[model samples]
Target chain A: MKQYQRSSILVIGGAEDKVHGKEILQSFWHCAGGTSAIIGIIPSASREPTIIGERYFNIFRDMGAKDIRVLDVRDRIHGEDKGYQEYVEECTGIFMTGGDQLRLCGLLADTPLMERIRQRVKLGEVTLAGTSAGAAVMGHHMIAGGSSGESPNRALVDMAMGLGIIPEVIVDQHFHNRNRMARLLSAISSHPERLGIGIDEDTCAVFHHHNEFIEVLGRGTVTIVDAQAMSYTNQGDVSAEAPLALHNLRLHILGHGDRYNIKNHQPIAAVVE
Target chain B: MKQYQRSSILVIGGAEDKVHGKEILQSFWHCAGGTSAIIGIIPSASREPTIIGERYFNIFRDMGAKDIRVLDVRDRIHGEDKGYQEYVEECTGIFMTGGDQLRLCGLLADTPLMERIRQRVKLGEVTLAGTSAGAAVMGHHMIAGGSSGESPNRALVDMAMGLGIIPEVIVDQHFHNRNRMARLLSAISSHPERLGIGIDEDTCAVFHHHNEFIEVLGRGTVTIVDAQAMSYTNQGDVSAEAPLALHNLRLHILGHGDRYNIKNHQPIAAVVE
Candidate 1:
């Protein structure tokens, strides 16, 4: 086991407040060393990688980061390129933008660039922030695509492999706003051992102390699904498209300033100042 | 443990040759006591349950059945009706037609009519034959719906509760014709403990001796997927829609006249007579 000196992972739901009170991004900015942060923006998930990459680069730059680099690796070759790999290794903070998670994984999966980022993040040397599709890729088991506004069932969600940045939990973005509770529930039905975290739009679940805890931030609430205590689920017994019944799954809804212990699956109320 | 004296289950893939030969249906008819058979047709899965039920009624009538009743229960109330429950109880064999499995389960699941059928089938007092969606619902864990031609992944299949006529196995119909290999593989990834039996069009996997053995019949073949020896699976690790990798899953393909030991997961070739 590696000893971590300092590590922080900021997971933001999609459609964060970019103009008024950019609290989530600002929190990410401060955690990335603020004025002295050497930031790298990865927008490979977007169809317009350059535009998306530049967008994040400008946001971090405007926050007074000493250096900002848009490392847009569009293909496997680009992902394997030494220049991109070096930037991923050297960046103090890395931000991944949202678009298509399949495309992102297709281009970067198993690449040296992702391996380096994973290594640095694991070593507590870099602060990583991802939003929307970016946030979806943080789990070892990723939800590549799924529909909302449906009952929880196997057909409601699609899952794939992820970057394993946070292997213990599966993350969903634009959660409650998009009626993704069913979708996330469908995902967790297959993986009861991992925690399911749904970050509402503009919300952030900031991980610290080696991902042992999460501090909810921003205006929206974070929904936590803990199935470790789940007694029964018809997931293995049922066919697709059928409504599922899951028993004993614990759910927690937390607002800004609320903290949660990931290891213990417990919630901590923030002390009023 | 309840000792099974004589129990036979015919799981037919869809599009069985009702016109020519009709080897699979003939086997089912013979197992149902041939000329002395008192059969009940449950077409609750079909949109036109009455029509589908009568169609099977006519087929059995043509086969010189002593008696045949089309027990077309379309709703839960109908499933609970004493008339339907009596028909289910008196029938020597039950034949379920293919349509929408979800609809079938919605109407009949947990109903007294279905409970009586389950009880009789488990007691080796009745022979049961279900085709297509009916076949899909034989397992304790059912495959309600799914898409074909996709790589094996969680998204490729949807699963729901089934009749559990055969609790130890998951069955898929129209196997080769519809290219349901990946679909069955996807279903089995979530349920490695249950045997996967994919019956090709016009084929049947006849389970006998308390479902411990299966004898293949009809023009097509039976593909058996046994994941008991599986060493690893990325099913829990990947998100939906992403391709999955399952290692050491043993697959067996058997043609007409071949036999298999379900408990041992071993195939026995046909003897030259």
Candidate 2:
């Protein structure tokens, strides 16, 4: 395991305004492996990243993190100065502003900006805070919601890959408002090998390194799906025009104050939250 | 495409206490898809399924369902019943009673009972309804969530694989009740080549055959995840002990009463609900 100076992620389902922004920032501050300089990566999609950056920048500023700096990944992805790399080197933490997770990931992907961010996180002492899409992109798979849940056969729905900072989880923004648990579970059940997480609007799941489980914050619930011994093929013998015939999957439920271990992928029975 | 006689599904998301069992049954009945007989599969897992079934069975009975048979997949998975295939063949719709989807699928999977059920669905006219886990297994992948948005570098946490019905859609139940959207999005986004659907409580998404768009029902919203263009890897160079790194992905929003067409494994735009 690569040691991180400060390792923590403040994952919020949505953060358009202040109602949960303060708490979200505090959570990141408390859990960031260690250190203080905060870097915010502003993305241009869905909405302006500057909006959420202001929220975090302000909170971080109050938290004694006066060296907060917002870097536009778009402007820095190819810049020769390695300004992003340099910024990450000196920063105690890095923040990914909320916008379209796809936008943020796209900008940082394969660029020195994301590479340096990864190096900083792996070295420890990088506090990661992302609201809405920012939060969604931290997962191995990111939720890109559209349309409704009429049937599992629609071709219009899909999940985009994200930053992979949190490889074990999949994320969706505005979870409760859009009613996404079903889709998440359905996605997990087919594989029945990956756990699915649903984070509610304005809520956060704080992961502290070496902790057996994560702590849930905010008013709404954080759902869990654990299928340990499941087997089935999603591809049935039916043709393209036929209805889907899926089989063989299971689910275990979890809520706030839950302790889940990644190695075992099973709940650790209750730990002091 | 293998022709189906009719298609319908009973979506039971809410508990009998929170949402009327009768209401769930009525929803199925109204979307009967011309089903005259509905079979309920019940297995012990939690207290809700049985309670719901007992209270709502009469309603379907009142609706003049020719036969409302309740059978245990365990008793019939391997048993040789001369009428087993005929029993399933005679039904216009086979309604799976809600309970532990795993236990139910476990017993019926790969058995003559499941084969019969599969054939019945293939015959089309068979409406399979699953509440909670029942809904969770409809998709090609199912979520067996056990809490791991924190550490994903390790092996998968959930078990997947269920009866093949819905090929691409990943289904999660009680979507809004529990925060599962993020997890589902992660599961599919990690793959970044599939779609995820979260079905809210007391709701259903009806799919019309021939690749037509899916229709929505109930008071809850349905969340969709699309990943037409996502670039990611194994979160390479990251360990199970730290926050993983991710790359690119996108997200789109959807709601209830809206229709989404799945073309090329991505969610296209649809009219708002």
Best-matching candidate per lDDT: 1
The list of candidate 1 runs beyond 4 A from truth reads: A1-6, B1-273
Model 2 docking tier (incorrect/acceptable/medium/high): incorrect
Worst 10 residues of 1 chain B by lDDT: B1-10
**TM-score per candidate, chains pooled:** 0.51, 0.49
- Where model 2 places Cα greater than 4 Å from the true spot, the runs are A1-5, A16-21, A33-37, A41-46, A75-81, A154-156, A189-192, A210-212, A233-253, A269-273, B1-273
Give per-candidate clash totals: 22, 111
**Strongest candidate by DockQ:** 2
- Residues B90-111 of candidate 2 have per-residue lDDT tens digits of 6665565556766656656667
TM-score computed on alpha carbons, candidate 2 = 0.49
Number of the top candidate by TM-score?
1
For residues B25-62, could you state the per-residue lDDT of candidate 1 as single tens digits? 77778777888888999999999987788788888899
Interface RMSD of each: 18.2, 13.2
What C-alpha lDDT do the candidate models reach, one value each? 0.79, 0.54
